[model samples]
Target: MNSRAPLNTAPPGMAEGLPVRFADVSWDSMRHDIEYVLVAPQRTRQPLLVFLHEGLGSVTMWKDFPYALCEAAGCRGLVLSRWGYGQSSPRPGHEKWPVDFMHRQARDFLPAFFEAIGHDTRADPPWLYGHSDGGSIALLHAAACPGRVGGLIVAAPHLFVEPVTLASIQQARDGYVTTDLRSKLARYHADPDSAFWGWNDVWLNPEFKHWNIQALLSAIRCPVLAVQGHDDEYGSMAQIDGIAQEVPQAELLKLDDCGHSPHRDQPARLIEASVAFMRRHRT
Candidate 1:
């Protein structure tokens, strides 16, 4: 059975208001504990905002951004480290992620995760705030379970694979081996190799090149705010543009002088835009 437990304590650099917690979630079709942090849980009735991290990100890697956004939006926030990220269980070395990993996350893991945490999405659908790979997962979830989602604020979400993205993933592979990337990632992930290779290997796999989700975008019925960096090295405007094309009601934001991660590169602007969007659609 799944259970909830208090984390030992906040990480050294975690913001004061956010309290970290752990939820034993049934993941990978197996029982696994996931690390998460709840911000402003006192605002229980407020619209919930769930933050989904980037591919290599975890609850700790998000730093204070979730807290900052939750405070600004006057909403409670749920920031979780996916199964193989952060303080959560490391991916088994013998296992390799399939190309449909993101699909499984949105279709399988997410619903179970909410149930494990006692969140009734049907009664009170939550707003999704996702970045990069997380953004794609949000899109897929919203599409798959439209009635259970309030809205979406996705940044740098890839609807289709791009040549530039593949190149950057290749570069990341090189950095992980030849540079200090592994050491840096080790600071956040329990097993750096687990986190790194789990994501890296799948993206670099030849078969994964055909992965795309544009067809599913039309299934999304909720309002969407798609954001992207003007200077993103991994993807071009086409990514967000494709989202707007499929999800016609979707609003788009292209930040100036920003790279891949708008939350880290331009937090204030992202917060302002996100807060405004939340207010507009607040239930």
Candidate 2:
């Protein structure tokens, strides 16, 4: 997070949180204890919104935004820390994520996480709100499990790799090495190394440069609103513009004077756009 970005304080009334377990999460057949939090669950009659965090983000990193969004949208929310993030199971020291890491997350881990939390996507699908890598994951999840996603609000999501993306990731790698980034990460992730290295290593890998999911977009059968900032350092407007190319039903939103994290940079505008979009497609 930029020093200028305001910090998010977790609000009151978090329900059914943490220490949820799921088995056989990967080829290694490792069991993982995924951490999660539910917000405003009392609104059972309303739609469910599931939040997926950024590459370096954890459950705690989301702070009160999930609650705030749910409140404004009159929806319930399920926020989770994916494996190797937040207070969930840390990545094995020697392990490296494959180029298909995001695919694995969307195809396998997400479904399992949903089940462990007792939210059956098929019986009652939920709207997905994601940022950065999380946004990509949400798209992949909706594509993979067609009818299971009610809708999506993906901010700064990457459908294809780009030189700018790699360059920014390299800058982050350098920051982690020469700055207090690791210490700052500790405030959110239990194992900052696991969180930082896991995302950094794979993204900087040569093979990952070719990673792309644009073809998967056509498979999505739900409404989608792709948001991006004109000043985003990690990617270009091509990210959201490319989304409109594939998923014709998807709407595009570009914010001015905002960076990568729109929810942090332009919360009011993002929230207003999201609430209206969610309602337009809400059942």
Specify the highest-TM-score model's number: 1
Residue pairs with backbone atoms closer than 3 Å in model 1 (clashes): none
Query: Candidate 1 overall Cα lDDT vs. reference?
Result: 0.90
Please provide, for model 1 over 1-283, each residue's C-alpha lDDT reduced to its tens digit, 9 standing for 90 to 100. Answer: 2356676577645677555677878766599888888888889889999999988999988888988998899999899999889988888998988999999999999998898889999999999999999999999999999899999999999888899999999999999999999999989999999899999999988999899999999999998999999999889999999998899889999999899999889999999999998899778
Question: CA lDDT, every prediction?
Answer: 0.90, 0.85
lDDT of 2 by residue, 79-109 (tens): 8778889877899989988899999998888
Give each model a TM-score.
0.97, 0.91
Candidate 1's C-alpha runs over 4 A off are 1-4
Question: Candidate 2 at residue 178, lDDT?
Answer: 100
Q: Assess candidate 2 and give its TM-score to the true structure.
A: 0.91
Please give me the total number of clashing residue pairs in predicted model 2. Answer: 0
